[model samples]
Target: MHQAPDILSLARKAPVMFNELELLQYREQQIPGSVQYTIHRYRRQSQFEVDDMGMLVYHRVEKNSKENYLELRFCISGNTYCRQKEIECDNCRFSLSNSCEQKSPSVDVLSFLFSPTHLSQFINGGKMKSMPDEIVHFRHASSFSKTLTLCGKTRTVLEALLNHNYSGSMENIFLNAQMQMLLLYSLECMIGEKEEMAFTCKFLANESDREKIEKAREILLQHIGEPITIKELSRKVAINECYLKKGFKELYGTTVFDFYQSQRMEHARYLLYEKGLSVTEVSMMLGYSSISHFSTAFKKHTGIKPCELLLR
Candidate 1:
């Protein structure tokens, strides 16, 4: 692998500018096992040069370094290590307590390795709190299923681009589409752990106040299509009507009825956009007895008629 300089030479050709000296300084501290590889225009797909096991290995940071990257890693053949604050995803640790094996050797972990600039685009100015001095780890986790997940079709499109297998506007289209797919995939994985934790904590909070809020959420989730009243909703979640109204907003940041409406609208959006369901069909599915009522609510919430949005 050291004999191959095609892509490596391309990377070297783009001399690391003076302004990127900080990144260079950080890169110098990488672990002994780490190596940097680049993919530019090469000729053969098979010869695009992966690790011995066919993984595209780019060791971007030192093992002990505190730098956190908006990173995507796949454990393809062996156990790997990763960490970020109090959160831990350890396969061996998780498996010692339980007896299940991970489904695949190659498992994808993303979102944590993203650069500060990339994250700031979505999070405003808040990305730097978790800064260059924080040791982010992504150790193997037992729960990582061997699903055929791709970070973006970009992994595939990137492979194509690196191999010089295609050309013209089609190449540009593939790259753009793949990049978007990869970005979405990275975002999804990045939030997966945090979202799961928040959900679990909210649903399982020992405090009565939080439980009541969760129950209120459950009621909304269960009866999204029903013309449910605050009074009836309070009864279902086992809370007083007044507390249901006020306590729910305090915990969830939204009124109980507002949450319920949001749930219904979200379901309607998924049906219309993802499942290709008809507006009337979705309206009926959600328990709305009348198409006009569903349409009115949908339009009121989304600012566009369901029929018009459906065409989009």
Candidate 2:
């Protein structure tokens, strides 16, 4: 466990080591014996374009002992583009000036590195037998990785982690709470409950159909300002309306309309609290017919009116 600090300490020295990445922000917290975690936000340097980016973790626990842990990586925003269709983005390199018409993509990534001891705390007694082997035996293995789909609940927690007004000790408390939530959601997604597994839409069992459902969720997020109906969403993703609706709930833990409304309200809170936008302005921007209507929806979703959030 002492190596945990040594592993995270590398984050502070990343700027000198990785020229292609600019570390924008870094925060680490240790909850005595409970857990130790680090949150790092980094921006990819435009001059260096990479098709794949990764972080390598290595440390010695004792004279002849070593340990390994899983890494969770999330791309908060940005897209890579290459002007020359013939060449891939990884092969294309740009100078510091970025003279090309299309500048290299600037990506923002939020990454989490957790200590193994902290991760073990989640497994309680007999429940450990039911947990995935990847988690149950996380320490002994040198390499184990799993890519998780970002459900609406996971995305909401990530959004709060990135955007929040708390500071000092309060900030620490808020972040730790959010990180725990992320862990819970990730585990649930990985080790689904028996009921949920049995009730999962049959159509979603196909890889192609699952991708379509994921694409539909992406479309909903993209059109937050002006929401599209389920029919339009289904047509865009080439999925049947009924399948799309049921599959969305099964995969994301929420109905299509509820997910869309939740996203809309979250964005509205950001605009009102962070952007200092008037309630009326936010309502119009979100495509509401009237401020009163927007207020009611916002209140229903957030338990507080748009104007009230602004005051905070």
Candidate 3:
């Protein structure tokens, strides 16, 4: 495996100028099968208030039998507010100098670089024609890039990668598994777009209605702990309940109830395994009325009870 560039080097190459850039975390490993991957978490803040910023990463792999590879990048952005409102200074939030209570906008980026040989193993038993372009073209093109939608599933995996408690070998195992999942979700999002375009609901043809449906989905995510009714969701987004349901299913590839339940269960599993929270605590945090009810619902979604998962 070749050495990849560090986060600071990549940040310096970005198009937008940032007042401050910090590399919060970085992890890299080479597995037994010659698979090498790296994770970079960065916090960036700009002084001049820009609408958008973009980064460009350029790398040249060492000459070898394997010349092609794939790169996956995920970015989550949010604002960080300071606790104290009175004290304020220029560049206080962006700089590490003064200890002031303030919140500023920050962007976190996670990137995964996969080797060609590692990816090729998946197609080793089959013909190249049967494989997807993302796989087949890895060996054909020098470099290519595609913008994929950051769906809910993809966001969940990215969040897990950002916040985890594993270390050493356990960390390596967890990262490798999550990287594969990111790849799977990316491919699925790409393929699902094609299918969606072929059979999109006519109701979504209107841009305003589509926005309303998207807003409804966001509301559903916000209230995962305490789910809202379909009528309430429609009212919040100011769209008809029937249109919201049909448009949501058409756009997101799942019903509202199923999506909400799946998100809740996934969060439950995260709280149990990662946070080490007790089943009862997680059950209550998720607004479950009783342990047995939570257990039954968890088992229905995950094929195992919460207690069983905790025991693992």
TM-scores of the models, in the order given: 0.36, 0.44, 0.43
Off by over 4 Å in 3: 1-14, 18-20, 25-35, 44-65, 79-105, 129-142, 194-312
Candidate 1 structure quality by residue, lDDT tens digits, 148-208: 2344443654344333433466645554444445545544544453345443234334355
Estimate the overall C-alpha local distance difference test score of candidate 1. 0.44
Candidate order, lDDT descending? 3, 2, 1
lDDT of 2 by residue, 162-210 (tens): 5576878787788778877777676676665432556457777676787
Root-mean-square deviation of Cα positions for candidate 3 versus the true structure, in angstroms: 21.4
Error of 2 at 73 (Å): 6.8
Q: Which digits, one per residue and each the tens of the lDDT, describe model 3 over residues 1-312?
A: 222223332334322312245655466667655446555444555542322111212122336545556666655665333333235455453464345544444556556766765666666564455215435335332222344667777777877876565778887788778878877777776566645665357877665677677667667767878858998988898988888888889876689898788778877987987789999999999998899999998899878889888776
RMSD of every prediction: 22.5, 20.8, 21.4
Q: What is the lDDT of residue 43 in candidate 1?
A: 18
Model 2 worst lDDT run, 10 consecutive residues: 1-10
